[model samples]
Target: MTALFVDDRYRGAHGIGRYAREVLGRLDVPWRDLGLDGTPYAPLDAFRRVPGPGAADVVYSPGYGALLRAPRQVLTVHDLIQLQTAWPGRAKFLAYYNGPVRRVVRRAGVVLTVSETSAEAIRAWLRDDSVRVVNAGNGCSAAFTPDGPREAASDPYVLFVGNTRAHKNLDVVLRAAAVAPGIRVRTVVPAAEAAEVRRLAAARGVAERVEVTTGVDDARLAELYRGAVATVMPSLLEGFGLPALESVASGTPVIHWSGCRAVAEIVAGRGWAVSDAHDAHEWAAAMTEAARSSRTVAAPSDAYDWDRTARVVSETLSDVLG
Candidate 1:
């Protein structure tokens, strides 16, 4: 069977692109890369031109952009942040997603989501309970493991790995670090937002203690994860807590916020959870514990490997096609 994988821009973002590549690589059946550009479709014409199950045999979309006219179509919904959050400019974001996108989600033969939290949100927002929740595995590379016996940096520091989005809650981590005075905190933000975050850090008087390094390659990122005293992620939400898994794979302990259910599932009994800090005392204690517990070993991450994810996706596709 030939499957048409629909995505607006295949290479635009790293996360969805990575997942799509992995699934496609593992699929047993032949697949076609159908994108919005250069195809015989107008800009945003993907919805109109999308081949149905009869034409393409089956359709698989890694993201929630495809509206299928075919009998069989599968789409992965990573998160429902738009439905759950009431942040500034929420109306604008909700407007684009409310009508057409919701229809695609409702009409798809199979709706795959990354986490139960997301699955619940989909059901609540779209008012459908039939969506299946599949947990995508997040594994650290062979590179994120202990790098021989390197001396810990003479200075004490904490680390955070995420883009500068409001949901990430970097300020909470920074505030926690500030109250802990002696501990320095380093964050790897996106290149475009590094300057703005740096300016914010300076204004907050934690400038000297904060270091922002942006646009790091995979090797450098591995080193950063391996060498940090601890990795902190105070995210308000996550589809899957990839960084926490990465921290465990690197044998680094983690301090995570308790807002997202996926984090609780991933770190349950294995890692520490910090509730939204009513004050700095709670955060300070969590950071200290994470720093001290830096030698945690998070092996056996193969359960969540790309191969496993691919196999599940392939099986689902096969069932649909048959």
Candidate 2:
């Protein structure tokens, strides 16, 4: 049976893009791209916008999007962050997830996720035990290791690997930077959000201390990880904490919010978990402690691998197609 994989997700630098690139490159089975590059969640245009996967026995999307009209399709629902958070578009997100997303999962061949934490949440949302929700997990790239070229910096700095999104919880880190005087913060945001992040840092009075960097490739990102005092995973929610996982793999410790279960699950013993997500004082204390502490170190990670992830995905595809 022939398979068609959604290649549009390979464009970005986020977790979904990484998943798409890694798994698609590693898969042993024969497949072709469906050439789809449009928004998959548009309720009205989904059927019209997405091209049909012609002559393909199976269709797959690496992100949390469904080929609503396809006969046999697979999806990777990273997380329901939109539904869980109380943002300005909460009602719209709630309607979308419950309406379009619910119908897709119920009909999908198999639903894949990044962590057990996310899998549990997805299953709970479904309420039906019949659907197959699998935790294919995530992997650390070979670039992020203990022994690597370290990024040079004048003072001790902690790394934050997300944008200014609300769920990314970047505000909490900005708040902590205000009180954590000894430690500098380096926030890596996308080019589109660079100016906004800088403005936010200035508003937070950490403009001098908080460095905003953009367009950091993996090699430079690994260097940044290796030299950091600690990597901060301050996300309010995540399907899988890829940044934290990569940080620990590089021998750098992490300071993550305790509510970030996806992060805490991987970096628990390898770093510190700040219990309060809202308390900036608590985050500041952890940042200060992490800047001074040497309780953690790097290792060539063995727990998660992209090869294994691809194998599971490949197997699932083969099983479902047959």
Candidate 3:
């Protein structure tokens, strides 16, 4: 049985691309890497009509950006954030993610997700009970672990990763860091967004303490996590919180803002979850506690392996084909 892991825009930079690569490495099936080679519309449009001699029996699109019209399809809904926050100018976002995209999701044979929180959000948003939930556990392979010459910095700091999307809730971290003079704040993102993030830090009165580094490679990321006091993921919403899992994989404790179901679902007792309503002092306290306990994170379990995720995809495809 052949399973097609469709990721039309397989640019190695983004998180969705990482998910596609990991799942493809795992599933024991003939796979395809139909990236942005041929496209007129968006890269997603190219995926919608991806062609080859080996037509797949089942297709899995982890990004949820592309609509698969295949006979048997599995759409992984990372989170239903489009319906939740309704951020500024959400109408445009909803036009792309809701309605038509959801119609494609309803046509899927199975709905796999990264966390139960995301699954619940999907079901509640659609008001459907039949959606099946499969938690794709998080893991960083041996390749992702720290090894080379770089080592942890001597100073205490909290790390943040991801773009400057409104939902990332970066303001909270900036606020907390401004009050905590002892700890520095570091962020990983594109250089284009650095000036704006710095403006934000300045407005919040932590401009001197906040440091933004653009273009971080995997080795630097591993080294950063290995040395950090704690990794902070304050996203107001997520389909699955990858940073939380990566922190655990890198043996750095995580401190996430509360209400992100993914963080609670995955890390449970392993890390700290703080309320969004908490003031800067409270968050600083949590950061201090996390730094003190950062060394406790262990290597994640085998279930988090990409191979295991691939095997699940292979089995699902075989069943669909049969």
Candidate 4:
């Protein structure tokens, strides 16, 4: 086991965690767990989590999480959404990305990303036209199959699977709730984020129209996807849109922001409707059409799958470590 796979993000319910969990179990590389206690954005964590001299031949990370001083490492940088979008800690995020995060990516032996859209953003961030950004794409997990126990709700709803990040464009959904009185919004967020989502729903005066939930496992999430008329991924930017892929996998269509090529890249022409996320009426109309849409359960035909992704990571690591 010459490669150390960071596993702390495995506990996450978001795309990063799901990527870590899926790829970690499928990688053919000789590797073992190397958990970092805190977030990779925390400067001090890099110091504490840095592997000592000769700890391993190389290290691999599934997401943007990184070690500042890992001599030889391979990591997935995901997206530069935080840098590209306006957020609460914009200045601090800039410092972290420019400081340690930039160095990590610049120094890494290999950089893997989920989509070409993210790869382009990462290349722009590096400011090096020659920098190679490997796009491994993203896979829809097995649990998100079209055949599943569907969630039954009192009101027909559209699904939103994400945290309350500013870039997530929750405003569109909230606005749609007001514009389209017939459409209900059901959001599934991490447990810690439930309160904030609830608060956002309340503050927007759509608390009754938007139902917030937490700690939904993959099976239940699949059910939710299968039940919803469609999934709404209103994110302004993303490394990759996992929810859209998952939703389409479960035989449901998706309403996504036309601006998000990341989501469009994976879904291809399948089960997707493009609309301007900034326009509430557009979202409302899309949601209305989705509520009236129906589809049959079919296996995902896309080439992206976890096994292939892990194989790509393994090959990249082998090439770097050799």
**Per-residue alpha-carbon lDDT of candidate 1 for residues 119-176, written as tens digits (9 for 90 to 100):** 6666677665664455444434455665544325666677888777777778777777
Those runs of model 3 whose alpha carbons end farther than 4 Å from true positions after fitting are 1-5, 35-58, 68-73, 128-133, 143-150, 290-295
Ten-residue stretch with the least lDDT total in model 1: 38-47
Clashing residue pairs for model 4: none
Tens digit per residue, CA lDDT, model 4, 1-322: 4545554454467888888888877878777666555676565665564644355567777766657767666778888877865656787678777877777777763589988888878777888654467888777788998876999987789999998888898887888888888888999998898889888888878888888888888898999998998888988888888898898788887788777888876666665555667888888888887777665435457677988888888777777777
Model 1: how far residue 76 lies from native, Å: 1.5
Which has the better TM-score: candidate 1, or candidate 2? Answer: 2
lDDT of 2 by residue, 1-322 (tens): 4555553544467777778888888877777777765555555633543455654566777876655666667778888887877767788887777876677778764688878998999999888788888888888889988887997888889999987888898888888889888889998878899899989999999999988888878889999998898898888888888899889888999988887788888886787788888788998898888877844575635768999888888887777777
Alpha carbon lDDT of each predicted model: 0.65, 0.80, 0.68, 0.77
* Candidate with the larger TM-score of 2 and 3: 2
Models sorted by TM-score, best on top:
2, 4, 3, 1
Q: What order do candidates take by lDDT, descending?
A: 2, 4, 3, 1
Provide the global lDDT of candidate 1 against the true structure. Answer: 0.65
Note the residue pairs that clash in candidate 1: none
Q: Best-fitting candidate, measured by TM-score?
A: 2
- TM, every model: 0.83, 0.93, 0.83, 0.91
Q: How far is candidate 3 from the true structure (C-alpha RMSD, Å)?
A: 3.5
Clashes of 3: 3
